[model samples]
Target: MRKYIGELGLIITAFIWGSGFVVTSISLDYYSAYQNMAVRFLIGGVILGLVFYKKMKHVQKGTVIKGAILGSILYLAFALQTVGLQFTTPSKNAFLTAVNVVIVPLIGWAIYKKRMDKFEVAGAVLAMLGIGFLSLKFSAELNIGDILSFLCAIVFAFHIIYTAKFVKTENPIHLTVVQLLAAAVMGFIILLFRGEAAVPIVDGAVFSLVYLGIFGTAAAFLLQTVAQKFISETKAAIILSTESFWGMVLSIAVLGEVITLKMAVGAALILLAILISETKPRFLKAMPLREKV
Candidate 1:
């Protein structure tokens, strides 16, 4: 029962993360990507830092450095993602960005030598087809932003793998809070380089920043880290893929976006692939232990 509840928490985190696209889109109207990320991570880091400061004493020395490395990867991932939002529609960006589900396994296999079963490969092929359908606009070539979003998927995959490994080694909350701070530190350094450190001060943008900071960045990651304690990393990735589904539903229901048959088919394929990849390995046959992450 407790494990199921933990899984449910991961699903909730995905929902919150999925809805961030629309919220982030709205915020983009008033803030640049660097500015938004800089502010969001800073505020989130501080808020989480306060909540977890007492717990910090419990963290070992090397964990901070490990957290920072993971944080830098995540920072690049989110930065690319937020910047990518500028060139793509919220829904499209949501779908493309969510392709990290497929990317995660590929990265795992490449870097960590984790091998996937046949179903996982099939799922990857299905998701590739889905990406085509989701982003296939006949009228225009894929824009720079769309391309950037796709690249962000790669960065995020590494981030996920690192996070999975690090979570097992460190206190989840400590790592979460410190990583948020590290991302903020990197963003601030970027703002300083861009000479736009003050661009985030507008009163009109505070609410949006707060939402990203409090709900999207801090709350979402906290939930993800804690919930990962109860689930396998691949299973966790599969669960979070639901965020794309929530993004599509919210876009239609709230933004009045039209639902196309291509999208439906593509989404179905991707979801089915995810289901198959996660279930197939465990149920069908046991593989060598070293290949599993």
Candidate 2:
């Protein structure tokens, strides 16, 4: 039941993040990328701190250190992706970012000496292929943006792995609060350095920022931190990769984008990847079944 709850939380997180694609498009019209990062993270951290004041009081130094590490990696990943988008097509950026689904298991195996699960390895590959079909434009020549986006994937993989490690020892609520606050601080510092600290006060921009802060940053990340306690980092990465599918659905429904056959195939592959990762298939088993008397 706990495992199911964790899976459900991650699914919802993916959905919320998927919806963020639309909201982010709207917000970008009014605010610079750096400004959006600063304001949304600030709002998210403040809201979480206010709601979980008791948890805030009990935050330990060790938790703060862990949270800061995760937060820094998170900010770096986003910063890379944001800058990458400036040079590359959005589709290529999205596909490259989703490559984290494959990187997570490799990181675990390489650093922690964890054995790679066959089912998860297959799922990760399928998920990456699905994301490629869903978003990639298949450009032959690589550019700086492609390099940055791939680096973003590596950083995101580290974020997922570290979140799993930290949640095992620290309180999820406290860790989440500190993580958001740390990221918010980093965002503000960068914004100030860039002279892009001004906030947009228009109603549409304000509403979009609040939506991103509350749902995208605060709620989605809180769910991710808590859910990772019950899910392996590889499985968690595969589940979160479904965000691309959800994003396509929202684009079709909200933005009235036409769906193509390619999208249908990509969606099916993503669903199959999740199923394979969740339910370890036994087709490769060598042992024969015995008949009961």
Candidate 3:
């Protein structure tokens, strides 16, 4: 039952993150990417900072600093995504950012000298096929949004690598807070220099920022950090990749975007590949051993 509950939490995390794309798309109508991200992270960071403060038991002075660095990296990652989204369709953006799945394993290999399993290689090929289908519409002229989305993928890959490596070394909650704060601070600096510091007076825009900050960024990141304690990093990444599935679904159902047959087929292949790659028979074999203990 506890295991199921933890898995459910992770599922919810994926759903929330998946839906973030739609919300962000709507928010873009009223706010620039930098402005929206800045506002959201600032509020989210404050909320998380307060919540995690009470749980801080270790006086390890360097913990906050490390988290802040992680937070800064994380901020750049999302900021790039938001800015990139401005020039790309939500579907295209989602698919591109999802490239982090492929990038993660490669990053892991480069940094940790880890070897790629056959399943992972298979997954990468499937993801690349999906990317080809996704980029079909933009074959002639890849827009700024697409370019930014690709860049975002690389940064996000690094963010995942750093999180997996550092989250255990530092206090999870503290690390979460620092990363949030760093993003918020970075967003603020960008907002100021862009001369867009004026608070978005539009009620709808303000509401969007609040939603993204509190729910998408803060609550989501907290859940991810906590959930990772229970699940392997690779599993967590695979599960979160479901965000693309949700994004595509939401785009079709909520936004009334037409779903093409190519998208349907491509998304299915990618999903099937991720499932096959993630569901290891070895892990299932060990279940009985775990239960006996």
Candidate 4:
């Protein structure tokens, strides 16, 4: 029961992130990617820094450096994702972003010589097919947005892997808070360089930025840091992979987007793949029956 705690945390994180797609879209109307990120992370970092002020005592030189690395990766990942959504449909961006889950294990296998089980491999294949059904139209030409989203997927995979390693040695809340601050710092530097530091003040933008900063960036990422300490990065990725599914559901239920047969089937396959990753193939296999006397 205790072991499953991390999985629960990750599921919650996924749900929060699922809402991010829509909220971010709203934010993009007011701020450029860097400006939005700059504002979002600054708000998140300050809030968490105040709320968890007690955790600051644990901060160390190593923590600062590690947090900066993680935060930089996070900023890049989120920046690319936010930027990519500009060119693609939210649905496509969400599903393509989830492709990082499949890439995680492959990265581990390649760089660290880590081996993936057969069930995990199967989940990857199923997930790939699901991605195609979810986002691809089998069109002759791919858009720049698709390419950007795919790159976002790759960057996120690195974030997941490195995060898993760092949380083991550092304090989760402290690391997470510093991570936000680091991203904010990087974003500010970018703003300084690009001269887009000034952000418009509007009611809708304010609400969107608050939701994104307080919940999406602060709460969700802290939970991820704590959760990944107990779970394998791969399993965590699989669980969070459901973000795309939640994105679809939220679009249909909240946004009143119409659903299609292909989408329904694709959603089912993605859910099935997640289940397979969690339970493995053996759980889904039927048992042999014996004749009764």
Better of 2 and 3 by lDDT: 2
Compose the digit string of candidate 1's lDDT tens values, residues 164-192.
78888789899888888999999989999
lDDT agreement of model 4 with the native: 0.83
Instruction: Put down candidate 3 lDDT per residue, 163-241, tens digits, no spaces.
Output: 7677667677787777787778888888889998886578767777788888888888887776766654555566666
Error of 3 at 265 (Å): 1.5
lDDT of 1 at 208: 79
lDDT of 2 at 137: 78
Cα shift from native, residue 209, model 2 (Å): 0.3
Tell me each candidate's TM-score.
0.83, 0.96, 0.82, 0.89
- Residue-level lDDT tens digits of model 2 in 4-58: 9999999999999999998999999999998888788888889999999977998
Which candidate has the highest lDDT of all? 2
Residues 116-202, candidate 4: write the lDDT tens digits.
Answer: 655665666676667667665664556778789889999999999999999999988888988999999999999999999777799
Best by TM-score: 2
**In candidate 1, what residue range of length 10 has the lowest lDDT sum?**
281-290
Worst 10 residues of 4 by lDDT: 284-293
Residue pairs in steric clash, candidate 3?
71-179
TM-score of 1: 0.83
Q: For every candidate structure, what is the RMSD over all alpha carbons to the true structure, in angstroms?
A: 3.6, 4.4, 5.5, 5.7
CA lDDT scores, all candidates in order: 0.77, 0.91, 0.72, 0.83
